[model samples]
Target: MRFFKYILTLTLFLALTKGYGQDLDKVDRMLSNYPANPSSTEELANRIKNDFSNDLERVRAIYKWIALHVAYDTKALGKPQRVRFSYRTLAELEAKKKQFRKDLALQTLKKRKALCEGYSTLFQNLCQQMNIECEIVPGIARRLISEIDRQNLPSNHAWNAVKINGKWLLVDVTWAAGWVDYSKMKFHQEFSSAYFASDPNEFAMKHLPDDQKWLLTDNINSKAEFASQPIPYKYFLGKNIKLLSPQKGTINMLKSTGVQFNLQNVPADTEIAYHFKREKYGQKVKSFTKADTLSFKIYSELKGKDELVIYFNGEPALGYKVIVK
Candidate 1:
């Protein structure tokens, strides 16, 4: 189980090239050895601005720097703390909010650690300093299969959306920085570029914003649909694989003759396997591949309500809830 959790965190980010064709490799390499100590967000933003001439590169620099340097504060998980502010006027309220954001960003920078809020705030502040438009988006993030179909889910996560060349791109610095090892309650500082300017449709898989306006898409799913979507594990991260069939997160085995899964862009050399929660050993599933698509089926013999976990080359890639009547 721990191995699965670790694998889940190792997902890859696809390099975004929707509008511009600038090579991010160069941007990353140039800022690879950035100074560890920066007195303030202004100094860091100035450094990035001086290094990159374009808005995309500047945003990438900020995203990469924070992803590489900042660590997720695991100790602060599940321990709720709140701060109250008193402001009779709208102007005063706005001023107080600004100060609060500044304070939180600075605290995260000084400690080199933060939860999602801290990560999003710091990213937004740096972007604003660089004259780039950025906003902190509050939403529900679904990672575990247990989160599927859970009732009355609250907004539990925060990320950012930045405007580049008149288009808003999604970024989740908290997830990009790394994942938490629940068994050890420790944070690992692995940098992933997947969350930087991710596609809105793909970003919607794990992130459901409280405000649909931030979804940045007309084909947005409702909260019910989002909650019922499949659980994409970390193995899907760097890979170009796509789930094509059984799109729903929860499947009724009684209505369907058999559960069939169709995926795209799966490598030829990849080995596939699956298992029910009651099964002791994983069964190798013979997959049929035609061009870039791969198809497989799970029989009804292994029935009842259980989890169906599919693996790619021995690593968990997708999970679905199976219910048999």
Candidate 2:
């Protein structure tokens, strides 16, 4: 009788442990089978199994692993030539670029020759392969008014909307995956997870979703009203502060003095403008503020600080090489 009792207990322990082990493996298998891009349809279906192998660890594991596995590519990101690029037709591009044997994510990772379109497309492909639901969103990053070409207007950028924990989270695997510089060439191969389950309010300034419905309670075509033209006064009028205040985490100014307060590594075309919290912005200005070209404030006075975000108008804020000191 005693022997039988011990044997039964051991058997149950072994069975439970074995089941747990299988689940852990299932999660890893789901992620590894597909490319980083979220467009692999068949593979994505298989991954759905992992999302449920262990309900307790499903969300935590998936979110952490993705953010950890992939990285953002800052150096490699920029305006691709104005060719007609489409995400729905990536398989066609792969066929034409180098046959279906090479996927956009794998190729882009190796060569680091991808634009916002390429990055977003690759992410979408990988997510699809893993059965992760995602979509492409277009938005403005900033105006391309540089010495090379001042006439360039606002361009477009793309990212993903993933369903995690029954919530559609905005993620930009392209931006999340930081860039790597290999000699003169760059290799984009680092993945971040914060953007995976990032909040809409936090993500919008940088990654505008393809569907505004992802974040909004109501349907509104907010992008159409998003000013594509350059708003000079916002930044042009502020004074420049040398350093960010210790408590404020903000650098305010009274006039545009050209004192560069690096808005961190915000996306290109993302303007750094903030409105007075007290000011009654009409319906147009109430929900969101205009994207401004961050410049040196003309007058130098540190009165009050404002909240900040990466407003994507043309491209993801992956470009600005100028670092904020």
Candidate 3:
């Protein structure tokens, strides 16, 4: 399984683009140095199919390997220019090492120096050849916490947005990878899978997918506009108000507008949620459970606000209104 894990991941990021500027001679050396896969790419595909009849298992295996094997380069940290890279540039340099030969995948395999593009491209190709649904998404990547208009940073960073069981999940093999110390060259194996299956809220803090469609939510703040250009808006802004769990006391939910809300999904052993502003007025608080209504207060209500914010499980899980006032 360990070897399987490594090969499968390598296969996933195993694609190459045709033309110059890619390492050519390096590729030749790679092909000559390393023998063919233990199992042919096609046979490996079949093996994967049998081993992982379930999608999640297969994806988890791939995620684990990428995180563990690939090393992140701190030298490249905040360096917009691609001075060093993964397989893609590795191939280019290798080709140069062997004196400018047209590059190929066989060569990239020889010396394992790849940039983000090479990793993503290779992963995309493996998915394609294996009939796995995958795509390499590019985007304006940033992770500014507060509302900042701009930061002097590299706009280009690439990652994968894969479809698993009809659900799109985010995976950043690059960030997951840990590389050598900036002062010295060595490998660190502390990989983070947090980038895999990440939430749109968290993802926006780091990587911005090149394709807007890969972004999971239209409700995300700092998201590029869906139709055209990017529109930087707070997810908790406009109708997206957040609920602060009353620390001193519990609050009751009052309904002024008719909105469909599920009480089951709400936090247990807490206060009530009210629809102060909905499309239609005339809402009343109804006690669904005996324990839910007790110790909760409706001391104050939001008026003329865009949306009545509510809290559940200490997080902003849902948005209640479109516009309050």
Candidate 4:
């Protein structure tokens, strides 16, 4: 009788483990079977539902599929030779926006490429069809270090806010797809799921949602606060460095006398360096390292427009554009 009881316990353990294992297996299957070309959205949605039993898993599956499959559209993002907007009035603009959103999903799927708006809309549409709550929040994305000081820029970016297990999560599929090679003006495929369900505070560093509700945190950031926060790039995140400072790279010398920035979690042995106008200026830059935070200061003597390139160790990490009056 004791032997039989032990056997039954072992059987239950095996069954439970397999039940948990099914999620991993399902994800593998879903990813492997992902279509190379466009397919019926409804059919794809049904397949995702049938594969994943839990809402969180479903959301993850969808996010992973899009992040791995979709390519960032460089042609669409490149600056055009001419500026033109067909809609002159608010009513016409609204109509055009409505139609544009309608086409984003289809165009993205067909081409397997998209800008941030298309990526966010595609993610939202997939979530909705799968009975998950998601929203596309349009706002400012300060991706380029040079964009830090620019003003009067329209809402130039969009990202998704998804609710999973009753908690709001932020995701940027467009960025996850890859980063733009600034020199070549081309997109590169670098898959990362770090943006999936990212921390609200960290997400706020780079993305400022037009809607306050999408902040997803109790400590909401005002426009002034957002503008003051340092730009958080993937390099900073990867190095586990927390930035504090001018909140932007493009600083007007007239507005601010000196350029100062703060850093946290910097390694004791890791060397920080800078180059002013491509000339090594490590000795000229003042730095203080204490505990986990490192602060650097560089006095500005700019007569016109120039760039300050920052280096970590020996490699270029970030660049800042300086404008002087």
lDDT, residue 155, model 2: 39
Say which candidate scores most in TM-score: 1
Which residue pairs clash within candidate 1? 12-237, 12-238, 13-194
The model with the greater lDDT, 3 or 4, is: 4
Better of 2 and 3 by TM-score: 3
Candidate 3 global TM-score: 0.45
lDDT for position 113 in model 1? 84
Question: Taking the tens digit of each residue's C-alpha lDDT, what string does model 2 give over 225-319?
Answer: 22212222112211121111111223333333322333322344444333233234311111222243233221222334332222233222211
Q: Please say which candidate is ahead in lDDT: 2 or 4.
A: 4
Better of 1 and 2 by TM-score: 1
Cα lDDT computed for each candidate against the true fold: 0.81, 0.40, 0.43, 0.69
Query: What is the C-alpha lDDT profile of model 4 across 3-56, one tens digit per residue?
Result: 354345334433432444546446746676777665755666777888788766
lDDT of 3 by residue, 96-193 (tens): 64332113222322333345754565455445545668877887664222212333444467888877656566777665665455456555766554
Judge candidate 3 against the unseen true structure and give its global Cα lDDT, from 0 to 1: 0.43
User: Hey, what RMSD does candidate 3 come out at?
Assistant: 15.7
Best by lDDT: 1
Q: How does each model score on TM-score?
A: 0.88, 0.41, 0.45, 0.67
